[model samples]
Target chain A: MRESDKDIIRSLKIFSDVDERLFETLVTAAYAQRFPAQVDLIHEGESADFLYIVLEGCVELFASSHGRETSMAIVSPVSTFVLAATVKDAPYLMSARTVDPSKLLLIPSQNVRDVFDQDPAFARAIVTELATCYRSVVKSMKNLKLRTAIERVGNYILRLHDKSGKADIVELPFGKRNLASILGMTPENLSRAFGALQSHGILMDGARIEIIDRAALETVSKPNPLIDDFRS
Target chain B: MRESDKDIIRSLKIFSDVDERLFETLVTAAYAQRFPAQVDLIHEGESADFLYIVLEGCVELFASSHGRETSMAIVSPVSTFVLAATVKDAPYLMSARTVDPSKLLLIPSQNVRDVFDQDPAFARAIVTELATCYRSVVKSMKNLKLRTAIERVGNYILRLHDKSGKADIVELPFGKRNLASILGMTPENLSRAFGALQSHGILMDGARIEIIDRAALETVSKPNPLIDDFRS
Candidate 1:
């Protein structure tokens, strides 16, 4: 790995507190690779051989069952995916694929477990990371269970609006199909939901969504921090 | 706390490996209380003051929005809940209630955090516990997204059947109303689904169900270990 890449990995929250020598050991055992867009990186039900950290571009974590597939999460740069599976020595619950040409660091799962056992800081960090992940999924469950598709889409748009610096227009991060899967809606349902949101004062022009009236939209979305806040 | 209660708490997976002194400290700061059925234990937006371990009976983790409530998980004896919220010092993302007259041990969130920081064993256990929780939620999300309501009910029956030692008779752990919420369906829909399952070789009588033909039921459920296996 390049010194620059080691520096980037070192800055990650999960690794930042590890002992320097152990961190060095981890990075030495790790390797980075680049993959083209739409390439399947891992498949569900496979043994988790490595813990993946995306250094650049985007990766989609998804799952399939009985001839059906759904998007589970979208991982962007500087974040790790599949840590739980790695730590537990369990099979990957979801498959991962690149949405854009991406670079990722693959740390052998055995090394991660070994380091985690030896390094208290790393163990604590893993605890925090996993707890955050658990809470996020719980929130997502609430979003899925408590809200209707239109409400989910409305709240999602409000989240984007806030993330884009309260800008009047916000771009969809990925394709509508992925967004539909993320929101637990069919593509046709998503389109219809977007149409329904127009009555609440938003305009969708392909991927670029214009928030004509933020207040009107919030009245409909009623985005709650317990469900919508990612940072917490 | 009673000595017996402490023994129960000590044997819990999250606390099993902690230093004896630390375990005593945690239990010293903890207290056990009994709640009647239908009592709310914690609200969704409330700060997580304590981590709870169910000792007897059952607790239902649930969430609500737009005046609609959904059951998240049903917690039984000798397992912890809200560990993610306690570890993160975040508000509870879901409300919890006793599904039956229940007893629970409550450890102050601060003490849990302090113990977690001081005891590497405890930290490691917490990591393992949280990772398990995260994976379970991911599985649930997949179950929700990839399957229809009837399929979910069918798979749920198969799970209960296996849990009952392959007995032809299996009892629903909770009432139809709560089961419906847990399955992400209305009670009416759950009834309809159960009615539909009768044609697939199962008979439902209130909370009691008889699996007349396991093979036929499995055919409809197509119970995939990737989605149905909780032990992993």
Candidate 2:
């Protein structure tokens, strides 16, 4: 097996636990593709052709409304993104783009369907993946409906800190503009929100954010399912 | 098989086309249970134990939001409802109730899992079912985000006309309030939306509605991949 192909399987949670022989079959069927930074692997209205397994770097999941894009999720290393479109072979609800120079495994949507047919475990994994996707969307809807801009940004920074193993400082995944869209706020609103959080001592930072006071932020936000967890 | 069960299966799109043996298996596995109007078939937050095939009358799918009831969908006769939750074995996201004296095929969720494990065709059926469910939700979201209350109600009526195969008239499965909730608008808003449409030639008489001018309604509210033409 090619080294890059091994990296592909290793990066995907759904395939990581499967035997090497099965991985080889999957790798044989898949083509390792490099997407340049900002390249779109999928578009909102296009028919789904493949399922992406991110080997390196990150990808953005976003929807466009009235000619503006809203970032829905950020797919990082070792994650199977867009399983819903792949399994259903339906047109994508959002577009996917590389946030960095990324290596991805392009498995034919048919291969995914065939695999699920033959492997119940694979079906179960895909089900879990889809369930997670649904829950994340539900969380997003709740966040859009319930939280204020400053509260959303503060909770988002806390999430990044938690994701980084409680590091004091963590770099933002995308620029403040993209992060604002993800939080369903305007760029100006996001800037103001960040400033407010910093003033309140809930968070602090330049490009890298520091969680100066987690307890205070959590108390204010009340950290519902959306703000408290990404997987939910 | 009981005559009523046979008639119900004949009406459903999924079971109507399958071979007799498969249909018989599905029908036999399902036990007919009756509930009085307003009785809960499945309660929100409870473990989802059964997949219901509504054979007689209507079921309203709803969840409580800040002490207010928000409807998810209306399940009509000869259609399977809550298949997604049943297959996942997740707690019910929405409560279901009989809007009238309802006879339903209560297939244990466990039976669904067992059947899917052994039958590839049945598994394919499930994939189709779930895929349809996902698409329906996506369409609803699009409608909610893109359309006004007036346009939403307009498209919904057109959708009903398409589903019931009635060019002139279609019956409301649930009341105006539940329909309003499903469309993500208020009852008063739905009433006004209907009134606005009536002034524009979309006809309504009590619980029955008639699209006197289909082209005008479609012109006012363009339904794209709309939640119309659904079969159980």
Candidate 3:
């Protein structure tokens, strides 16, 4: 059973591309845990005890403002979160709640960082993960600071396409209100942003959003690493 | 001459506590270059050519929208900016321009990284620096999305106090407009924000801003990372 679970972890990007020995060590250090929907796995400003990997269901990451929460990212199956705090041994800046019945692997922070100290390649892998996290946050900042609401949703559709293996007709990841917070706007504003984009040729059908005229949409919404459409 | 410069490099937090021999290797690898104010040293979306240490003067890191630019960080002498770009071997996300006549020591991208590979302690140093950068950006994001304009200015004054070594009379490193951008508001809004904070009992005379009421300010402005209070 342990060997089969090791095989499961072997498929994750952090472990998948690495040598068998490192994968073996990581799997040995990490153990699987589970959570139910709406469960607060890690409270904002709480102790940094464990780093989590979502093996099933979904999680919402958010920060609070004036008692209201703002969504940052929604993590689905096969992704890690809360690492910035875990690695640094600092209190989490954001709280995470399970958005669906979930299965996770919680690696004790000390056990995880011990791998960093014990293995150079593993250290390199963690560095890559942190760098990737840093880039994602930068992209988020660019999205929030550089683009207005309408362009953000338009390009968000493009990103959804890209994230869903660059396929057509991927379902929406989060509910509209959560997505609005992630996009740095209110839900009413997000609905208006979507309407404005639709009038400009981007179309939405229930959970599925489609770019009817990709070129015109790109022209209308200038994209960059923020929007992931540079020429726009 | 080398010894004096080593002393200078040793004064920087990023390099000050580094291994002496590794520091010498970096010193040997670096070339000192001077630039006039307003010259762009690094441009967004381009390969980062060199990792720089400003030996004199200041540089502004700013990002642009449809021609509107927002100042990101005002990097002063003896500090390193863009460490993430150099360490991660990625294109810079923002452009850097000289804000004052500057002498900067340029360490080739390859050299900074190669040094990282050769010395584990220096590699640890680099990781610490990257962590610091990530934390600062995270703090900036909190300031942007969570805090009110008046709260931001009040906290900015507290930050300035720390930046000036807890000194009461502190001259700012950047012009008000640039600082305003970094604080994530229009210059006029920044003026109003400062005015609001002053009305709330924070006192200012020229660049020498003072926190007359600490508890009131703390109630209004959030402080995470106690390191802000511990400059040394």
Best of the candidates, lDDT? 1
TM-score per candidate, chains pooled: 0.98, 0.78, 0.88
So what's the TM-score on candidate 3? 0.88
lDDT of 3: 0.73
Worst ten in a row by lDDT for model 1 chain B = B124-133
TM-score of chain A of each: 0.97, 0.89, 0.88
**Top-scoring candidate (DockQ):** 1
Q: How accurately is candidate 3 docked according to DockQ?
A: 0.36
Rank order (by TM-score, best first): 1, 3, 2
Query: In model 1, how large is the Cα lDDT of residue B61?
Result: 94
Per-residue lDDT of candidate 1, residues B1-232 (tens digit): 8998888787788888899999989999999999999998999989999999899999999998878889998999867899999988999998999999999999999999998888878887877878887888898888898988999999999999889999989999889999998889999999999999999989988889999998888888878898899798
* Share of reference contacts kept by candidate 1: 0.82
lDDT of 1: 0.90
Query: Which TM-score values does chain B get in all models?
Result: 0.97, 0.83, 0.84
TM-score, cand. 2 vs. native: 0.78
Worst 10 residues of 3 chain A by lDDT: A223-232
Looking at model 2, give its docking quality level. incorrect
